[model samples]
Target: MMGGSAYENVGKKWDLGVEEQEWFHGLLPRVEAERLLIEDGDFLIDDDNSILEMVNQYCLSGRPWLDNSDIVLKNPIFREKWLLQNDDIILDRKLGKGYFGDVNKGIYKPMGNAVAVKTCKETFTQEQTKTLLTEGRILKQYAHPNIVRLIGIAAQRQPVLIVMEFVEGGDLLNHLKKQQKPFTSQQLIKMCDDIASGMAYLESKNCVHKELAARNCLVGNGLVVKVSDFGLSRDKVVHTMSDKNKPIPWKWSAPEVLLNGK
Candidate 1:
Protein backbone atom coordinates (compact mmCIF):
# COMPACT_ATOMS: atom_id res chain seq x y z
CA MET A 1 0.00 0.00 0.00
CA MET A 2 1.39 3.42 -0.95
CA GLY A 3 0.57 6.28 1.33
CA GLY A 4 0.08 9.61 -0.29
CA SER A 5 3.43 11.23 -0.93
CA ALA A 6 4.51 13.54 1.89
CA TYR A 7 3.37 16.22 -0.53
CA GLU A 8 -0.20 14.99 -0.15
CA ASN A 9 -0.01 14.57 3.62
CA VAL A 10 -0.93 18.19 4.29
CA GLY A 11 -4.72 18.08 4.62
CA LYS A 12 -5.05 14.64 6.17
CA LYS A 13 -2.98 14.41 9.35
CA TRP A 14 0.54 14.51 10.65
CA ASP A 15 2.50 12.52 13.18
CA LEU A 16 4.84 15.47 13.55
CA GLY A 17 5.68 16.98 16.91
CA VAL A 18 4.35 20.45 17.69
CA GLU A 19 7.57 22.12 16.63
CA GLU A 20 7.48 20.06 13.46
CA GLN A 21 3.94 21.23 12.86
CA GLU A 22 5.11 24.83 13.06
CA TRP A 23 7.74 24.09 10.48
CA PHE A 24 5.09 22.48 8.31
CA HIS A 25 2.70 25.37 8.61
CA GLY A 26 5.38 27.76 7.47
CA LEU A 27 5.07 26.16 4.08
CA LEU A 28 1.39 25.31 3.91
CA PRO A 29 0.91 26.44 0.31
CA ARG A 30 3.96 24.53 -0.83
CA VAL A 31 2.52 21.24 0.39
CA GLU A 32 -0.64 21.89 -1.54
CA ALA A 33 1.26 22.40 -4.75
CA GLU A 34 0.99 18.69 -5.61
CA ARG A 35 4.76 18.36 -5.96
CA LEU A 36 6.95 16.02 -3.91
CA LEU A 37 10.16 17.21 -2.35
CA ILE A 38 12.67 15.89 0.18
CA GLU A 39 15.59 18.11 1.08
CA ASP A 40 18.13 18.58 3.84
CA GLY A 41 16.80 15.50 5.61
CA ASP A 42 13.56 17.41 5.80
CA PHE A 43 11.00 17.24 2.98
CA LEU A 44 10.31 20.34 0.97
CA ILE A 45 7.16 21.01 -1.02
CA ASP A 46 8.53 22.44 -4.24
CA ASP A 47 11.22 21.24 -6.64
CA ASP A 48 12.09 24.73 -7.82
CA ASN A 49 14.60 24.95 -5.00
CA SER A 50 17.65 23.35 -6.62
CA ILE A 51 20.09 23.37 -3.73
CA LEU A 52 18.62 20.38 -1.94
CA GLU A 53 21.04 18.83 0.52
CA MET A 54 22.40 15.37 -0.06
CA VAL A 55 20.39 13.86 2.75
CA ASN A 56 20.92 10.39 1.35
CA GLN A 57 24.17 10.25 3.31
CA TYR A 58 24.70 6.58 2.66
CA CYS A 59 25.82 6.89 -0.95
CA LEU A 60 28.32 4.99 -3.08
CA SER A 61 31.55 6.16 -1.50
CA GLY A 62 31.06 9.75 -2.69
CA ARG A 63 29.27 9.53 -6.02
CA PRO A 64 25.79 10.37 -4.82
CA TRP A 65 24.23 12.11 -7.81
CA LEU A 66 23.03 10.28 -10.91
CA ASP A 67 24.83 10.81 -14.19
CA ASN A 68 23.12 9.05 -17.08
CA SER A 69 25.61 10.42 -19.59
CA ASP A 70 28.57 8.85 -17.84
CA ILE A 71 26.63 5.79 -16.71
CA VAL A 72 27.72 6.61 -13.19
CA LEU A 73 26.88 8.68 -10.12
CA LYS A 74 29.10 11.49 -8.89
CA ASN A 75 29.44 12.81 -5.39
CA PRO A 76 32.43 14.84 -4.19
CA ILE A 77 35.47 12.59 -4.73
CA PHE A 78 33.94 9.32 -5.89
CA ARG A 79 32.42 8.08 -9.11
CA GLU A 80 30.27 4.99 -8.45
CA LYS A 81 29.88 2.79 -11.52
CA TRP A 82 26.20 2.35 -10.75
CA LEU A 83 26.65 -1.34 -9.92
CA LEU A 84 29.12 -0.40 -7.20
CA GLN A 85 26.74 1.98 -5.45
CA ASN A 86 24.51 0.77 -2.60
CA ASP A 87 23.27 2.15 0.70
CA ASP A 88 25.63 -0.24 2.39
CA ILE A 89 29.08 -0.55 0.88
CA ILE A 90 29.19 -2.86 -2.17
CA LEU A 91 32.68 -3.97 -1.08
CA ASP A 92 33.26 -4.62 -4.78
CA ARG A 93 31.08 -7.72 -4.96
CA LYS A 94 28.62 -9.08 -7.50
CA LEU A 95 25.62 -10.54 -5.70
CA GLY A 96 22.93 -11.02 -8.37
CA LYS A 97 20.06 -9.39 -10.18
CA GLY A 98 16.92 -8.81 -8.12
CA TYR A 99 13.25 -8.25 -8.91
CA PHE A 100 13.12 -4.58 -7.97
CA GLY A 101 16.81 -4.14 -8.72
CA ASP A 102 20.19 -5.74 -7.96
CA VAL A 103 21.84 -6.92 -4.74
CA ASN A 104 25.37 -5.97 -3.70
CA LYS A 105 27.55 -5.72 -0.62
CA GLY A 106 28.25 -2.10 0.31
CA ILE A 107 30.62 -0.54 2.79
CA TYR A 108 28.79 1.02 5.72
CA LYS A 109 31.72 3.30 6.52
CA PRO A 110 32.90 4.60 9.93
CA MET A 111 34.17 1.09 10.59
CA GLY A 112 32.34 -1.54 12.65
CA ASN A 113 29.21 -0.77 10.65
CA ALA A 114 29.34 -2.77 7.46
CA VAL A 115 26.06 -2.63 5.55
CA ALA A 116 24.44 -4.13 2.48
CA VAL A 117 22.69 -1.79 0.14
CA LYS A 118 19.79 -2.82 -2.12
CA THR A 119 20.03 -0.94 -5.41
CA CYS A 120 16.79 -0.94 -7.41
CA LYS A 121 16.22 -0.05 -11.03
CA GLU A 122 14.72 3.29 -11.82
CA THR A 123 12.40 2.30 -14.64
CA PHE A 124 9.28 1.08 -12.90
CA THR A 125 5.66 0.66 -13.84
CA GLN A 126 3.13 2.68 -11.89
CA GLU A 127 2.57 -0.34 -9.68
CA GLN A 128 6.25 -1.09 -9.27
CA THR A 129 6.92 2.48 -8.26
CA LYS A 130 4.27 2.22 -5.60
CA THR A 131 5.74 -1.03 -4.35
CA LEU A 132 9.20 0.46 -4.15
CA LEU A 133 8.05 3.41 -2.10
CA THR A 134 5.99 1.35 0.30
CA GLU A 135 8.72 -1.23 0.66
CA GLY A 136 11.20 1.44 1.75
CA ARG A 137 8.84 2.94 4.31
CA ILE A 138 8.27 -0.41 5.98
CA LEU A 139 12.00 -1.06 6.05
CA LYS A 140 12.59 2.21 7.87
CA GLN A 141 10.04 1.29 10.50
CA TYR A 142 11.52 -2.05 11.54
CA ALA A 143 13.51 -1.36 14.75
CA HIS A 144 14.88 -4.67 15.95
CA PRO A 145 18.64 -5.26 15.87
CA ASN A 146 18.01 -8.65 14.27
CA ILE A 147 16.31 -6.97 11.33
CA VAL A 148 18.34 -5.05 8.77
CA ARG A 149 17.78 -1.39 9.48
CA LEU A 150 17.15 1.01 6.62
CA ILE A 151 19.76 3.74 6.70
CA GLY A 152 18.36 5.98 4.00
CA ILE A 153 17.24 6.13 0.39
CA ALA A 154 18.22 7.92 -2.83
CA ALA A 155 15.60 8.22 -5.55
CA GLN A 156 15.75 9.17 -9.20
CA ARG A 157 13.68 8.47 -12.28
CA GLN A 158 15.18 5.04 -13.14
CA PRO A 159 17.58 4.03 -10.38
CA VAL A 160 16.67 4.03 -6.71
CA LEU A 161 19.07 3.03 -3.93
CA ILE A 162 18.15 1.70 -0.51
CA VAL A 163 20.86 1.83 2.18
CA MET A 164 20.59 -0.75 4.91
CA GLU A 165 22.84 -2.27 7.55
CA PHE A 166 25.02 -4.90 5.91
CA VAL A 167 25.31 -8.32 7.50
CA GLU A 168 28.89 -9.44 6.86
CA GLY A 169 28.42 -13.06 7.84
CA GLY A 170 26.29 -13.59 4.72
CA ASP A 171 22.85 -15.20 4.55
CA LEU A 172 21.71 -18.53 5.98
CA LEU A 173 21.64 -20.45 2.68
CA ASN A 174 25.29 -19.77 1.92
CA HIS A 175 26.28 -20.31 5.52
CA LEU A 176 24.38 -23.60 5.69
CA LYS A 177 25.98 -24.90 2.52
CA LYS A 178 29.42 -23.37 3.05
CA GLN A 179 29.73 -24.83 6.50
CA GLN A 180 28.03 -28.23 5.79
CA LYS A 181 28.92 -29.40 9.28
CA PRO A 182 25.95 -31.07 10.80
CA PHE A 183 24.40 -29.23 13.67
CA THR A 184 23.04 -31.04 16.68
CA SER A 185 19.29 -30.98 17.27
CA GLN A 186 19.94 -28.53 20.08
CA GLN A 187 21.76 -26.17 17.77
CA LEU A 188 18.97 -26.27 15.21
CA ILE A 189 16.49 -25.69 18.01
CA LYS A 190 18.46 -22.66 19.15
CA MET A 191 18.52 -21.34 15.59
CA CYS A 192 14.79 -21.74 15.22
CA ASP A 193 14.22 -20.14 18.60
CA ASP A 194 16.31 -17.12 17.65
CA ILE A 195 14.36 -16.71 14.44
CA ALA A 196 11.10 -16.95 16.33
CA SER A 197 12.27 -14.31 18.75
CA GLY A 198 12.81 -11.92 15.88
CA MET A 199 9.53 -12.80 14.18
CA ALA A 200 7.73 -12.46 17.46
CA TYR A 201 8.79 -8.83 17.54
CA LEU A 202 7.48 -8.18 14.05
CA GLU A 203 4.24 -9.91 14.98
CA SER A 204 3.82 -7.84 18.13
CA LYS A 205 3.62 -4.81 15.85
CA ASN A 206 0.74 -6.45 13.95
CA CYS A 207 3.14 -7.32 11.16
CA VAL A 208 3.66 -10.63 9.42
CA HIS A 209 6.75 -11.84 7.59
CA LYS A 210 5.29 -14.14 4.94
CA GLU A 211 8.67 -15.11 3.50
CA LEU A 212 10.78 -17.01 6.05
CA ALA A 213 13.13 -19.30 4.21
CA ALA A 214 16.68 -20.18 5.22
CA ARG A 215 18.02 -17.70 2.66
CA ASN A 216 16.44 -14.64 4.28
CA CYS A 217 18.28 -15.05 7.56
CA LEU A 218 21.86 -13.96 8.22
CA VAL A 219 24.20 -15.42 10.81
CA GLY A 220 27.17 -13.60 12.25
CA ASN A 221 29.94 -14.63 14.62
CA GLY A 222 28.65 -16.05 17.92
CA LEU A 223 25.60 -17.32 15.96
CA VAL A 224 23.86 -13.95 16.02
CA VAL A 225 21.00 -14.05 13.51
CA LYS A 226 19.56 -11.10 11.63
CA VAL A 227 16.91 -11.14 8.93
CA SER A 228 17.38 -9.34 5.64
CA ASP A 229 15.24 -8.53 2.61
CA PHE A 230 11.67 -7.37 2.93
CA GLY A 231 10.70 -6.67 -0.66
CA LEU A 232 7.34 -8.34 -0.10
CA SER A 233 6.52 -6.84 3.29
CA ARG A 234 3.27 -4.86 3.28
CA ASP A 235 1.04 -2.88 5.60
CA LYS A 236 -1.68 -0.24 5.38
CA VAL A 237 -0.56 3.04 3.87
CA VAL A 238 -2.80 5.89 2.78
CA HIS A 239 -2.78 4.59 -0.80
CA THR A 240 -1.07 7.20 -2.92
CA MET A 241 -1.20 5.44 -6.24
CA SER A 242 -4.69 4.25 -7.09
CA ASP A 243 -5.32 0.48 -7.22
CA LYS A 244 -5.60 0.70 -10.98
CA ASN A 245 -2.06 2.02 -11.14
CA LYS A 246 -0.52 -0.20 -8.47
CA PRO A 247 1.61 -3.06 -9.81
CA ILE A 248 2.94 -5.84 -7.60
CA PRO A 249 6.28 -7.60 -7.83
CA TRP A 250 5.32 -11.29 -7.96
CA LYS A 251 8.47 -13.29 -8.62
CA TRP A 252 9.27 -13.60 -4.92
CA SER A 253 5.74 -12.66 -3.86
CA ALA A 254 3.03 -15.19 -3.26
CA PRO A 255 -0.29 -15.38 -5.12
CA GLU A 256 -2.06 -13.28 -2.50
CA VAL A 257 -0.02 -10.16 -3.25
CA LEU A 258 -0.48 -10.71 -6.98
CA LEU A 259 -4.20 -10.81 -6.32
CA ASN A 260 -3.92 -7.76 -4.03
CA GLY A 261 -5.14 -9.66 -0.95
CA LYS A 262 -7.93 -11.24 -2.96
Candidate 2:
Protein backbone atom coordinates (compact mmCIF):
# COMPACT_ATOMS: atom_id res chain seq x y z
CA MET A 1 0.00 0.00 0.00
CA MET A 2 1.01 3.63 -0.41
CA GLY A 3 2.98 5.35 2.35
CA GLY A 4 4.14 1.97 3.75
CA SER A 5 7.22 -0.17 3.25
CA ALA A 6 8.95 -3.17 4.78
CA TYR A 7 10.70 -1.90 7.93
CA GLU A 8 14.48 -1.78 8.20
CA ASN A 9 16.39 -3.00 11.28
CA VAL A 10 18.67 0.00 11.58
CA GLY A 11 19.15 -0.01 15.38
CA LYS A 12 18.03 -3.34 16.70
CA LYS A 13 21.01 -3.43 19.09
CA TRP A 14 20.01 -0.75 21.56
CA ASP A 15 18.66 -2.00 24.86
CA LEU A 16 14.90 -1.77 25.15
CA GLY A 17 14.03 0.89 27.73
CA VAL A 18 13.93 -0.35 31.33
CA GLU A 19 10.13 -0.41 31.02
CA GLU A 20 10.03 -2.41 27.81
CA GLN A 21 12.90 -4.86 28.12
CA GLU A 22 11.04 -7.80 29.61
CA TRP A 23 8.28 -8.23 27.05
CA PHE A 24 10.83 -7.57 24.31
CA HIS A 25 12.79 -10.68 25.19
CA GLY A 26 9.69 -12.85 25.51
CA LEU A 27 8.62 -12.33 21.91
CA LEU A 28 12.04 -12.52 20.22
CA PRO A 29 14.53 -15.37 19.79
CA ARG A 30 18.06 -14.74 21.12
CA VAL A 31 19.50 -15.17 17.63
CA GLU A 32 17.06 -12.53 16.40
CA ALA A 33 18.06 -10.25 19.28
CA GLU A 34 21.77 -10.59 18.60
CA ARG A 35 21.41 -9.70 14.91
CA LEU A 36 20.30 -6.14 15.80
CA LEU A 37 22.96 -3.67 14.67
CA ILE A 38 21.66 -0.06 14.48
CA GLU A 39 21.42 2.96 16.79
CA ASP A 40 18.05 4.76 16.45
CA GLY A 41 17.75 7.37 19.21
CA ASP A 42 17.98 10.16 16.64
CA PHE A 43 14.81 9.36 14.68
CA LEU A 44 11.66 11.50 14.99
CA ILE A 45 7.99 11.50 13.95
CA ASP A 46 6.64 14.50 12.08
CA ASP A 47 3.15 15.58 11.16
CA ASP A 48 1.79 14.52 7.70
CA ASN A 49 3.76 11.31 8.25
CA SER A 50 2.34 7.95 7.18
CA ILE A 51 2.46 4.80 9.33
CA LEU A 52 5.79 3.82 7.83
CA GLU A 53 7.01 7.34 8.43
CA MET A 54 5.99 7.19 12.09
CA VAL A 55 8.08 4.04 12.38
CA ASN A 56 10.91 3.58 9.87
CA GLN A 57 11.57 7.27 9.29
CA TYR A 58 12.66 7.50 12.92
CA CYS A 59 14.77 5.28 15.17
CA LEU A 60 11.97 4.78 17.70
CA SER A 61 10.20 2.48 15.27
CA GLY A 62 13.22 0.34 14.56
CA ARG A 63 15.26 0.70 17.74
CA PRO A 64 16.24 -2.40 19.75
CA TRP A 65 14.70 -4.73 17.20
CA LEU A 66 17.18 -6.55 14.94
CA ASP A 67 17.24 -7.87 11.39
CA ASN A 68 14.14 -6.00 10.37
CA SER A 69 11.22 -8.06 9.17
CA ASP A 70 7.74 -6.86 8.20
CA ILE A 71 6.42 -7.49 11.67
CA VAL A 72 7.37 -4.09 13.13
CA LEU A 73 6.95 -4.40 16.91
CA LYS A 74 8.29 -1.34 18.68
CA ASN A 75 7.46 1.20 21.40
CA PRO A 76 5.82 -0.77 24.18
CA ILE A 77 2.41 0.89 24.45
CA PHE A 78 0.75 -0.75 27.46
CA ARG A 79 2.42 0.23 30.74
CA GLU A 80 0.01 -0.76 33.53
CA LYS A 81 -3.43 -1.82 34.70
CA TRP A 82 -4.48 1.63 35.80
CA LEU A 83 -7.06 1.82 33.06
CA LEU A 84 -9.31 -0.20 35.30
CA GLN A 85 -10.26 -0.01 38.94
CA ASN A 86 -8.83 -2.33 41.63
CA ASP A 87 -10.95 -5.27 40.57
CA ASP A 88 -9.44 -5.75 37.12
CA ILE A 89 -7.47 -8.88 36.36
CA ILE A 90 -4.92 -8.11 33.67
CA LEU A 91 -3.92 -11.08 31.58
CA ASP A 92 -1.14 -9.16 29.85
CA ARG A 93 0.15 -5.59 29.83
CA LYS A 94 2.08 -5.29 26.59
CA LEU A 95 4.93 -2.84 26.20
CA GLY A 96 6.67 -0.55 23.63
CA LYS A 97 3.90 -1.01 21.09
CA GLY A 98 3.72 1.89 18.69
CA TYR A 99 1.00 4.46 18.01
CA PHE A 100 -1.55 2.84 20.27
CA GLY A 101 -1.87 2.17 23.97
CA ASP A 102 0.13 -0.82 25.01
CA VAL A 103 -2.53 -3.44 24.32
CA ASN A 104 -3.53 -5.83 27.12
CA LYS A 105 -5.52 -8.95 27.95
CA GLY A 106 -7.72 -8.73 31.07
CA ILE A 107 -11.17 -8.54 32.56
CA TYR A 108 -13.06 -5.29 33.16
CA LYS A 109 -14.27 -5.24 36.75
CA PRO A 110 -17.76 -3.73 36.52
CA MET A 111 -18.05 -5.71 33.34
CA GLY A 112 -17.13 -9.26 34.27
CA ASN A 113 -15.43 -11.95 32.14
CA ALA A 114 -12.26 -12.07 30.05
CA VAL A 115 -11.81 -9.35 27.41
CA ALA A 116 -9.04 -7.65 25.48
CA VAL A 117 -8.26 -4.02 26.33
CA LYS A 118 -6.55 -1.62 23.94
CA THR A 119 -5.78 1.50 25.96
CA CYS A 120 -5.23 4.72 24.05
CA LYS A 121 -1.72 5.45 25.26
CA GLU A 122 0.50 8.36 24.26
CA THR A 123 1.29 6.51 21.03
CA PHE A 124 -2.27 6.99 19.93
CA THR A 125 -2.21 9.15 16.81
CA GLN A 126 -4.85 10.61 14.54
CA GLU A 127 -4.22 7.89 12.01
CA GLN A 128 -4.36 5.15 14.65
CA THR A 129 -7.48 6.65 16.17
CA LYS A 130 -9.13 6.51 12.79
CA THR A 131 -8.14 2.88 12.46
CA LEU A 132 -9.35 1.96 15.96
CA LEU A 133 -12.74 3.60 15.63
CA THR A 134 -13.31 2.13 12.22
CA GLU A 135 -12.30 -1.36 13.27
CA GLY A 136 -14.41 -1.24 16.42
CA ARG A 137 -17.51 -0.06 14.62
CA ILE A 138 -17.02 -2.71 12.00
CA LEU A 139 -16.48 -5.44 14.55
CA LYS A 140 -19.63 -4.42 16.39
CA GLN A 141 -21.70 -4.64 13.25
CA TYR A 142 -20.95 -8.33 12.86
CA ALA A 143 -21.95 -11.15 15.20
CA HIS A 144 -19.66 -13.77 13.74
CA PRO A 145 -18.15 -16.26 16.17
CA ASN A 146 -15.00 -16.36 14.05
CA ILE A 147 -14.11 -12.73 14.79
CA VAL A 148 -13.15 -11.32 18.19
CA ARG A 149 -16.08 -9.57 19.83
CA LEU A 150 -16.16 -5.96 21.03
CA ILE A 151 -18.30 -5.91 24.12
CA GLY A 152 -17.83 -2.22 24.97
CA ILE A 153 -15.38 0.65 24.79
CA ALA A 154 -14.02 2.55 27.81
CA ALA A 155 -13.11 5.56 25.67
CA GLN A 156 -12.21 7.56 28.77
CA ARG A 157 -9.14 9.81 28.72
CA GLN A 158 -5.82 9.46 26.88
CA PRO A 159 -5.41 5.78 26.24
CA VAL A 160 -8.82 5.14 24.73
CA LEU A 161 -10.28 1.85 25.87
CA ILE A 162 -11.49 -1.00 23.64
CA VAL A 163 -13.05 -4.06 25.28
CA MET A 164 -12.95 -7.25 23.29
CA GLU A 165 -13.42 -10.96 23.84
CA PHE A 166 -10.26 -12.37 25.43
CA VAL A 167 -8.84 -15.04 23.17
CA GLU A 168 -7.74 -17.86 25.53
CA GLY A 169 -5.18 -19.83 23.55
CA GLY A 170 -2.11 -17.84 22.46
CA ASP A 171 -1.62 -16.46 18.95
CA LEU A 172 -0.82 -18.82 16.09
CA LEU A 173 2.90 -18.27 16.62
CA ASN A 174 2.86 -19.62 20.17
CA HIS A 175 0.66 -22.52 19.18
CA LEU A 176 3.18 -23.29 16.44
CA LYS A 177 5.88 -23.57 19.11
CA LYS A 178 6.19 -26.19 21.89
CA GLN A 179 7.55 -29.39 20.29
CA GLN A 180 6.18 -31.45 23.15
CA LYS A 181 2.75 -29.89 22.65
CA PRO A 182 2.72 -28.53 19.13
CA PHE A 183 -0.40 -28.79 17.04
CA THR A 184 -0.56 -31.63 14.55
CA SER A 185 -0.50 -30.94 10.82
CA GLN A 186 -4.24 -31.58 10.89
CA GLN A 187 -4.66 -28.93 13.59
CA LEU A 188 -2.68 -26.46 11.54
CA ILE A 189 -4.99 -27.13 8.60
CA LYS A 190 -8.00 -26.55 10.83
CA MET A 191 -6.52 -23.23 11.97
CA CYS A 192 -6.16 -22.22 8.35
CA ASP A 193 -9.80 -23.10 7.82
CA ASP A 194 -10.92 -20.92 10.73
CA ILE A 195 -8.78 -18.03 9.52
CA ALA A 196 -10.11 -18.32 5.99
CA SER A 197 -13.66 -18.38 7.25
CA GLY A 198 -13.04 -15.19 9.22
CA MET A 199 -11.35 -13.50 6.27
CA ALA A 200 -14.22 -14.39 3.99
CA TYR A 201 -16.55 -12.75 6.44
CA LEU A 202 -14.34 -9.67 6.67
CA GLU A 203 -14.04 -9.50 2.87
CA SER A 204 -17.77 -9.81 2.45
CA LYS A 205 -18.05 -6.74 4.66
CA ASN A 206 -15.44 -4.93 2.52
CA CYS A 207 -12.87 -4.76 5.33
CA VAL A 208 -9.19 -4.64 4.45
CA HIS A 209 -6.53 -5.71 6.94
CA LYS A 210 -3.55 -4.19 5.15
CA GLU A 211 -1.21 -5.60 7.81
CA LEU A 212 -2.37 -9.17 7.87
CA ALA A 213 0.10 -11.69 9.34
CA ALA A 214 0.24 -14.90 11.38
CA ARG A 215 0.18 -12.98 14.65
CA ASN A 216 -2.78 -10.91 13.57
CA CYS A 217 -4.81 -14.08 13.51
CA LEU A 218 -6.06 -14.61 17.08
CA VAL A 219 -6.46 -18.22 18.21
CA GLY A 220 -8.95 -19.24 20.89
CA ASN A 221 -8.54 -22.03 23.46
CA GLY A 222 -7.34 -24.64 20.97
CA LEU A 223 -10.52 -24.23 18.98
CA VAL A 224 -10.93 -20.92 17.08
CA VAL A 225 -8.79 -18.35 15.28
CA LYS A 226 -9.69 -14.90 13.97
CA VAL A 227 -7.90 -11.95 12.35
CA SER A 228 -6.96 -9.03 14.67
CA ASP A 229 -4.80 -5.90 15.10
CA PHE A 230 -6.88 -3.33 13.25
CA GLY A 231 -4.45 -0.39 13.07
CA LEU A 232 -2.95 -1.29 9.67
CA SER A 233 -6.32 -2.21 8.21
CA ARG A 234 -8.46 0.10 6.08
CA ASP A 235 -12.12 0.67 5.43
CA LYS A 236 -11.48 3.15 2.61
CA VAL A 237 -9.46 3.79 -0.51
CA VAL A 238 -5.66 3.19 -0.48
CA HIS A 239 -3.13 4.06 -3.14
CA THR A 240 0.54 4.45 -4.06
CA MET A 241 3.24 6.28 -2.13
CA SER A 242 5.73 9.02 -2.93
CA ASP A 243 9.13 8.12 -4.41
CA LYS A 244 10.89 8.36 -1.02
CA ASN A 245 8.47 6.19 0.87
CA LYS A 246 9.88 4.56 4.05
CA PRO A 247 8.83 1.06 5.06
CA ILE A 248 7.13 -0.68 7.98
CA PRO A 249 7.46 -4.34 9.06
CA TRP A 250 8.94 -5.27 5.66
CA LYS A 251 8.57 -9.01 5.87
CA TRP A 252 4.86 -8.54 6.40
CA SER A 253 4.48 -6.28 3.38
CA ALA A 254 4.42 -6.89 -0.34
CA PRO A 255 7.71 -5.98 -2.08
CA GLU A 256 6.28 -3.32 -4.40
CA VAL A 257 5.27 -1.14 -1.47
CA LEU A 258 8.91 -0.60 -0.59
CA LEU A 259 10.62 2.37 -2.27
CA ASN A 260 14.12 2.10 -3.52
CA GLY A 261 16.48 4.56 -1.81
CA LYS A 262 16.48 7.69 -3.94
Question: Each model's C-alpha lDDT?
Answer: 0.52, 0.52
lDDT tens digits, residues 54-74, model 1? 322212233323554322222
Residue 135 lDDT (model 2): 54
Give each model's clash number. 14, 24
67-148: candidate 2 lDDT, tens digit per residue: 6544343332221222222224354655224346566777776666767777665566755564555555556665677777
- Lowest lDDT 10-residue stretch of candidate 2: 20-29
Q: How accurate is candidate 2 locally (lDDT)?
A: 0.52
Q: TM-score each candidate.
A: 0.58, 0.54
Give the C-alpha miss distance for residue 128 in model 2, angstroms. Answer: 4.7
